[model samples]
Target: MLPEAKPGPARRLVDAIRYGNSVVLTLLAMLCALLVGAIMIVIADPPTRSAMGYFFSSPWDTFTRGWHAISAGYVALFEGSVFNPDSLYSNGHTPIFGPISNTLLNAAPLILGGLAVGVAFRAGLFNIGVQGQLIMGAICAGYVGFAFRLPPLLHLLAALLAGVIGGAVWGGIAGWLKARTGAHEVISTIMMNYLALGLLNYLLGISGFQAPGSNQAISRSVHGTARLPHLLGPNLSLHLGIVIALLAALGCWWLLTRSTLGFSLRAVGANPSAARTAGMKIERSYVVVMLISGGLAGLVGCSQILGTNHALTGDIDAGFGFDAITVALLGQASPRGTIFAGLLFGAFRAGGVVMVANTGIPADVVLVIEAVIVLFLAAPALIRAIFRLRESRGGGVGVGQLAKGWNA
Candidate 1:
C-alpha cells in the first residue's frame, strides 16, 4: 500500500508549536516554581507577607519604604558589587541603580561558567567539576596577576591566560583519564574537585603566596597594573571583564554551531560508535571537549579576579561554579540563553541581600527557592502532572524539553 501523505510545512510548524513542549513547558515550570517559592517565602517569614500586604494596601505610604528596606539594606550590595551609584536623596524613591549594576557585575562570571557547562551538555558530557576548574583557574590567575610584572595590557592578559591554562589542564586531566583508562568523566571531575581545593589551600597558606599579615588563607591582591579597569565611572565596581565574558559566550556559540571541531564533538557526544564509523576520533574529541570546557570554566576565575574580587580567597566563588549548572539548564544550554539565565539567577542572588536586610527572611530562603526551581526544571514531568497539562513533542516532558530545547 502507498504511504500516507506527509504533513505540509505549515502543518508541521503548527504541530511543533502545539506539541514541541520545550520552551513553553520549561517556562511554565519556572512560573510554578516561582509561585511555590513565593508561598514558601511567605510561610518562612510571616512578617514579610504582612509587610507586603500593608504596602499593597497603601500605594505611597509604605510601598517605597518596604522596597528600600528590601533592596538597599546593609549599605546597598549593588553599589558594593558593581558601580557605586550616586546617592540621589529623593523624597521617597530609593536609588534604583543599585540592583541594576550589581546584576550585571555578578552576571559576568555566571556567563562564562554557564557557557562551560552548556557547551559540554551539547556534547553529551556532564562536567560537574567546573567548580574545581574555576578554582584552579582562579589560583592560576591570582598567581600571575600578583607575581608577574608586565606591560599595562599584557599583565591583565597574562592573568587571564594563566586562568585558561590552569582550567584547561585540569579539564584535560579528566578527559585523558577517561580516554586512556576508561574512567568516567563525572567521577574523574569530581575527584579533581578535591585536588583543586586541596592544592589551593596549600598554596594559599604559604608565606610568599598568602596575603601579608591577613591571617586568612587567601592570595595577595593582584597588582594595580593587572587589575581590570572599571567600565563605569571611576571607583565603580563594574569592570571591563563583563564585556570579555559576553564576547567569550558569543565565541563559544559560534564554535559549537559553526566549526568542524564542534560538529565532531557533538557527533561523538550523540553516539560515539556512530561517530567513529563516520571517521571521527571519539577519544580525541573527548579530550578536546573537556579541555575546552575547562578553559571556559577558567574564564570565570579571570572575571572574578579581574572584575570583582581582585584577590583570591577561599570564599571568592561562593558556589557560583556549581550554580552555573542551574544557569546553563535554565538557559537551555544555548550561549545566549545562558546569559539571560545568568541574569535571572544573578538578580535573585543580588536581591537576597536586600531580602535579608529588610525582612525577617533569612537569605537562605532564596537558596531554597533556587533549589526548588532547579528541581522542578530538572523534572518537568512532575510539573506537567501537577499542572495537568498534555504532553508535548518531547515525550519526557519539561526536563526533556530543557534537554531538547538547547537547539530549539
Candidate 2:
C-alpha cells in the first residue's frame, strides 16, 4: 500500500470544532431562548408597548427604555442566582454567599436525579418512575428518621441506607417486569408513579405516618440526629447534600468509565443481541443498572427529607423526577455534563423567582425558555437550518435513538 496521508491543518481545525460542536450548540440554544424570552417580556410589558409605539418618533428614548427593562431583568437574574452585591450591605446577617448557597441547595437534588436518569440511559433503560422511587425512599427514610432514635452518626447513616434500599427495590420491580414479562418500562413506570402517589395518600391517612394532633398529610419531622448537617452553618441552607451529590457524580464517572459492569451495560445498550451473544447477561444487567440508578434517585429524596425538608409531605416530590429527564437530556447523559446542567437549571429556578419579583414578568416564562432550549436541542436539523452551520462529526444522542436501543 502507498503511504497514508495525514490530516492537514485545516482538516484538524475542522475536527476540533466538530468535537466541541455539541457544547457550542447548547450555548447557542440558550442564547436563542433568552432572546425569545426578552421579546416576550417586551411584548408583555405595557410600558414597552408605549416605547415601541415611539420607536420611529423617538428612537433614542425607545432604545433606552427597552435596554433598561431587559438589562434590569437579567441583572436581577444574576443577582438572585449567583450573587447580589447590594445584599452585602443591606442584609446585615445574610452573607453574600446566600444566593450561591441557595443555588447549590437547589442543584443537589437535581444532580442526583439527573445522574439517576443518565445512568439508566447508559444501560438502555428508560427510568421514568424516579418519582415513585423517590417517594418510596422518602417513606423508608422518614420512617427510620422518626420511628427510631439512634446515635447521631448511626441514625443518619441508617436513614440514608433505608432510602437507598427502598428506591432500589422500587426500581428493581420495573427491571424484573421488563426482563420476565417483556413489559415496556415506559408504561410500567408511568403506572408506578400513580401507584406511588396513591400509596402515599393512603399512608398519610394512617395514624403512624400522620403527625400527632394534625390532620394534614405530613409526616413528623426527623429527629435532629438523623438530619443532614448544614455545611455552611445554620445561616445558609447549604448542606452535606451538595457534597453527597458531588461524590455521587464522581462515583458515576468512575462506574461508567472504568468498571467492567459499566462496559457490559454500554455493550448491552449499544447492541443487546451482540452483548448476549458475547455471553453478557442482558436481563441481569438491566436489574443491576436500575438498582444503581434507583439508589441515586433515592439520594434525591434523602436530600429533601434529611437535608432540607426534614419531613415528608404529600407533595414532597415537587416534580424533581420529571425535571431530571430534561437535565439528563441537556447533559447528553454524561456525569460531568449532568452536574453542570443541573447547576444551570438550578440557577434558572433561583433566578426566575427574582425575575418575576423585580420585573413583573411571570415566573412561567422561565419554563418557556427551558422548553425552547429542549426543543432546539431535540431538533438539530432546525438549529443547523437556522444558523447555516455544518453538521458535526459526532452528533448528539436523540430520544428516538434512546427508545430504539430499548429493544436492541
Candidate 3:
C-alpha cells in the first residue's frame, strides 16, 4: 500500500482558520504596542517615578499587582466596547446595550464619511474635504430640521435632503475647479473645508436664521415629528439613522460593483485620458463623485442632528469628520471594513473611560495605545515586522496604498 501523504501545517488548517488568523494578527499588533508601552513605563521609572506611580505603587508590588491590573483593565476595555455585558456596576440592571448602542451611534457617521473617502480613493482622488462637507451637511440638516413646518417624517427626510444638497453643492465647486482649472483636489478640498466651517457658523448665528430668544448662536430644537424614532422606548438613545446608514452602504456597494455609472467612474479614475478617448464623460464623473462624497459626508451630520444630538450646535461633528479619515484608511476603503473599523475606534473611546475609572491606569495611556494601533495599521510595514508577515512591499496591496489618483 502507498504511504499516506503527509500534510504541512498550512494544508492541515482550514481556510476559515487562516482567515481568522489574519484578524488575530492585527489584534496582536495592538497588544504588542501595549506591551512595548508597558515596558517603556517600567524601564523609565519602575513604578516609582511621577508618571508610573500615578498608575500604581512600588516596583515590587507592580509586578505582582500593577502588571495584572493594567492587563485586566485593557481587557475590560475590549469587553466593554464590543460585546454584551449583562452585569451591573451598581444595583440597577446593567444595560448591555450601552457599548453596543454607543458603537453604532459613533459609527453611523463614520460609515457615511468612510463611503465618501472610499469612493474618492477608488477614483484616485484624495478628497480631504469630508470635514468641511460634514460641517456643512450638519448645519444644513440642522437648519431644516428646526426651521421647517412639515410633517414629522417628511421634515426629517427634508432635513437630510437639505444636507445632501448643501454638501453636493460644496463638493461640486471643488470638482468644478478640478475639471475646469486643473486645480489639485487636495489643495482645493483643504481650502473648501475651512470655507464650509465659516459658512456654517455664519448661517447658524445669523439673526434672521438663528432661533428666537436665543442670544447664543445655535439652531432651534428639531420638531418632534422630524426627529428619528428609537426602536426602544424614549429612555434608549439609538435611532433610525443607523438603518439609513446601512442602506446607504448597500446602495454604494451596488453602485460601485453593478451599475454602468460605476463602470464609468472606475474607468475615469483608472485613466481619464483613456476614458476621454473612449467617450466617457470624464468631467462629469469628477463632478458627480465629489458631489456624492459630499452628500455622504452631509448624511453624517444629519444622522448626528436628527438621530442623536436633536439639534445643531457648533460642537456638532466633534472632530468625527477628521476621525473618519483614519476609519476609512483602517477599513481599507471597503464598506464593511469601514463599519468594523468604526466600531473598533468607538469601542476604544467608550471603554477607555471605564478602564481608567475602574483601575488606576491613566486614560491618556489608553488613548496613546489607540493612537499607536492606528499608526501601525496605517503602516503595514510596522505590523509586518511585528508579526513577520511574509508578503513583500510589492507582493500585494499595502495599507498606505489604499487611496489612489489624488496626485494626478
Candidate 4:
C-alpha cells in the first residue's frame, strides 16, 4: 500500500473555512441585525426625522442626531442587560447586580425551552409543540403547587416532577402518532398548541383552578412552599430555576455526546434507513426523543409558573415556545450553543425594556432585530453570500439540515 500524503496548508485553510465558519457567520449576522436596528432607531427618532428633512442644508446635524439616537438606544440596552455605573449608588442590593439578575431571570426558561427544541432537532424530529407541552406541564404543576401542600422541599420537588411527567406525556402522544400512524409532526404539533390553549382556557374558568373572586383567566397563586428559592435574596428576582437550567444544559450535553442512546439518535438523525439496518429501533427512538424533548420544555414551564410568576395566567407562555425555535436555530441545535443563544435572547428581553423607556424607541424594533437575526440564521446561503464564505464540502448541519430532518 502507498503511504498517504498529508494535506497542504492551502488545503487545511480551505477545510477550516468550510467547517469552522459557523461562528464567523453568527457574528456577522448579529452585526447586520444591529445595523438594521440602528437604522430603525434613527428613523423612529423625532429629532433625527426633523433633521433629515433639511439634510442638504445641514448634513452634519442629521448625522449627529442619528448617531446620538443609535448610541443612546444601545447604551440603554447595555445598561439594562449588563451593568450600569449609576447602579452603584442604588439602595440595598449590590452594585450592578440588578441588570445581571434580570438577564438570568429571563434566560432561565429560554435555556430550557431551547434545549427542548435542540434535543428533538438532534433526533431528526421537529418537535414544534413545545408551547402545548409547556402549558400542560404548567397546568399539572400549578394544580399540584396550590391544591396540595407538602413540606417546602417535597412540595417543590413534586411540582417539578409533575411538570416533567405532564410534558413527557404530551410529547409522547405526538411521537406515537408519527411513529404508528405516519402523521406529520408539524401539523399535529400546531393542532396541539390550539388544543392546549383551549384546554387552559376551560380549566381557568373552573372555581378550583381560577383565582378566587377574580374574573380573569388566571390560576391561583402557588404556595410559598412550592416556589423556587430566590438566589440573591428578595431584592433580586433571580431564582433557583437558573441553576436548574444550567444543570439541565450540562445533562443534555452528556446525553447527546457521551451516552449510547446519543449515538443511536445521531445515527438515526443522519440516516434513518441506515440506522434501521444497523438494528436500531427507529420507532422506539422517535418516542423516546419526543418524551425527553417535552420534559425539557416542562422545565421551562416550571421556571415561569413556579419560579417567576408564582401563578399560571392565560398569557403564561408569552411566546417563549415559538422563540425557542429561533434559539435552537441560532445555536445550531447544540447544547452549548443553545445556552449562549438563550442568554443573548434573554439580554434582548431584559434590555429592550430599558431601551424603550429611555430612548423612546418602539418595542416593535426589538422584535424586528430578533426576527432579522433568525432570518439570517434560517438562510445560511444568504449569510455565506453576504460574507463571501466558502460552503462546506458535501452538506453541513445548518438550517438545511433541520429542514431535511422534517422530511425524515
How do the predictions measure up, each by TM-score? 0.83, 0.92, 0.84, 0.93
- Predicted candidate 4 versus true structure: per-residue lDDT over 325-402, tens digit per residue: 888888878888889999999999999999999889998888899889988877878877876777766564354577
Report the C-alpha lDDT of model 1 over 1-408, residue by residue, as the tens digit.
999999999987776545535565667766766666555554554445456666757656444454444444324434433334455555324444555667777788888899998887877777889989999999999899998889989998888899999998999999888778889888999899888988888888999899999888888989988888987665446688679889988998898889998887777766678889999888887788889999999988888886688788876667888999888887878888899888777877776665576555567766766777778777766766776766664455433334433433
Go through the candidates in order and give each one's C-alpha lDDT.
0.76, 0.85, 0.73, 0.87
Count clashing residue pairs per candidate. 1, 0, 4, 0
Off by over 4 Å in 4: 1-20, 91-95, 391-399, 404-408
Q: What TM-score should be assigned to candidate 3?
A: 0.84
Which regions of candidate 1 fall more than 4 Å away from where they truly are? 1-20, 46-96, 393-408
Worst 10 residues of 4 by lDDT: 399-408
Best by TM-score: 4
What is the lDDT for 341 in model 1?
A: 83
Evaluate residue 269 in candidate 3 and report its C-alpha lDDT on the 0 to 100 scale: 78
Clash pairs, model 2 backbone:
none
List model 3 lDDT by residue over 1-408, tens digit each.
999998677764543233324355457657776876565434433343444554454456556554666566667676666654544564446566766676677777877888888777767677789888888888788778777789877887898899888877888888888888889998999999888777867877877667788988677787887788985657657688778878888888888778998778877777778889999988888888898888888888888888888767777777777777877776766677777777777777777666666655666675566667677766655666665665542343444355443212
Candidate 1 clashing pairs? Answer: 19-393
Evaluation by lDDT, superior candidate among 2 and 3: 2
- Model 2 stretches with alpha carbons more than 4 Å out: 1-20, 50-63, 394-401, 404-408
Q: How many backbone clashes does candidate 2 have?
A: 0
Q: What is the Cα-based lDDT of residue 227 in candidate 2?
A: 96
